[model samples]
Target: MEITDRTFPAALVALSGIEFPWDYNEKTEEPAPSNIDYEPYDEFDSAEETTDWIRSWTGNKELDGDAFRMFGQDGTGGIATLWLVRPGQPLVEQPVAFFGSEGEIGIVARSLGEFLWLLAGGVGPQEAVEFGSDSGVPHDELLAVARKYSGIEPRTPAEVLAAAREEFPSFNRTVESWCR
Candidate 1:
């Protein structure tokens, strides 16, 4: 799916004004270490770059990046992406996933809609998969944005994380298989 999809762009626009602790400083290529927050990319990674990174990450030149669309990253350079596991489906239908810089991986949300709720609940990709740390601090602005775009009822962080993992139980194993 194209990165210019309606829902994703709308969500990004909604989140444009909010400041997070993990926002990357392009000048320095670093993030503040104080708070658990998301650092959205100014744009999605190009197809070529995504493919190259995936090949490098898995050490499998035979693999292509068509299965993923990386959109953002965490403070530590952990990436957040739309995992297009559902064939012939729109981008919104795909699951949102995270691949941490520290070798952590997980499906964070069932879809972009669920992802908004995850963000509303103050859980970023890294937080959801890594230590499963619950910030317990809700972002009302993000919640509002999520509701505006998704119109889905708010869910707890734990619920979103669990559902995603349950839905894609083999994500880790599948990804690991690609590693040489």
Candidate 2:
């Protein structure tokens, strides 16, 4: 997560272009229905809540200045740039990767389990709080989870994992093994 100033803008621009319809459910290895949606998010609350949840998970990092910087193609478009700054260090624009095609810049999920819960239909802040109780979010960490990624639009499992890998490369094999 070491982002150079030169790469920051490029990362933001690339993130804003993230689209979907990832060949996840539809196994092109086999033949299946086109079950993925690669469209811009239409739900504002869901998107915002999700963003809040991610921010909280990051120990309440600021998005505009000291921590992360968000840029969108337009005021109403999806995200473009998400700059994460380490204390006393240069900013790192996280890998906001995608599945199939790129759509727009999007927020990252706090954890794998949280992403799974969200995929399972946890949409609102209160619902996320309840889901946290049942989904191993831990009582102490509940507030953090609720605060981050709660209303922001979620990336797909594949996308989330990809970004997580970029952020925590060593955890990939462990996380995969655990998921299986």
Candidate 3:
């Protein structure tokens, strides 16, 4: 299935059952801090908006935003995006990566399918790099969803990161080149 297909959204909804430091919204601006819990937005950013953000992030006006489709953000406002490196391939086959608010970047999963397992294993993009796979409590609901959708065996967060980086060794350099 395509990344923009209904299945992708459904998977996100299913994974939403787990408590995170954020809420999913269709649209949001940079959030302000409050005494209450910090709630970040996990909703998918529109393609045009994502493109604009990418261009701004890299300070490169000539770059096309088609290479990325940002889907979520952590409480600290780090972005989670699907990287479309495999030209001519479906979005589902693309890799999922994170660009943190503080210049942290890493490929979190080799594909959308692997990403489901990552969620099931209780690791987000930031957590996977910052805290590793053992940080969060695993969720059964996410596990079931991962099994149902991906049919791949569960893996540790470290394994996921390694696999993605191996498959796309040039990802970091590519992003670096886009930087001003």
lDDT of 2: 0.31
What TM-score, to 2 decimals, does candidate 1 have?
0.84
* Model 2 lDDT per residue over 1-180, tens place: 433342323322332243422232244442112221223232212335535633543334342122233332222223322334243343332322221112222233344233432333322122222222122222223223423433344444444434544565543243233221
lDDT by residue for model 1 (111-154), tens: 88888888887778877886463644577777887889765787
Candidate 2 accuracy as TM-score: 0.24
On TM-score, the stronger of 2 and 3 is 3
Q: Lowest lDDT 10-mer window, candidate 3? A: 30-39
lDDT of 3 by residue, 58-156 (tens): 888888666777777776677887887776676677789888777778888998789877776666777765655565556576678888776577776
TM-score versus the correct structure, for each prediction: 0.84, 0.24, 0.77
lDDT comparison, 1 vs 2, better candidate: 1
The lDDT for every candidate, in the order shown, is 0.76, 0.31, 0.68
Best model per lDDT: 1
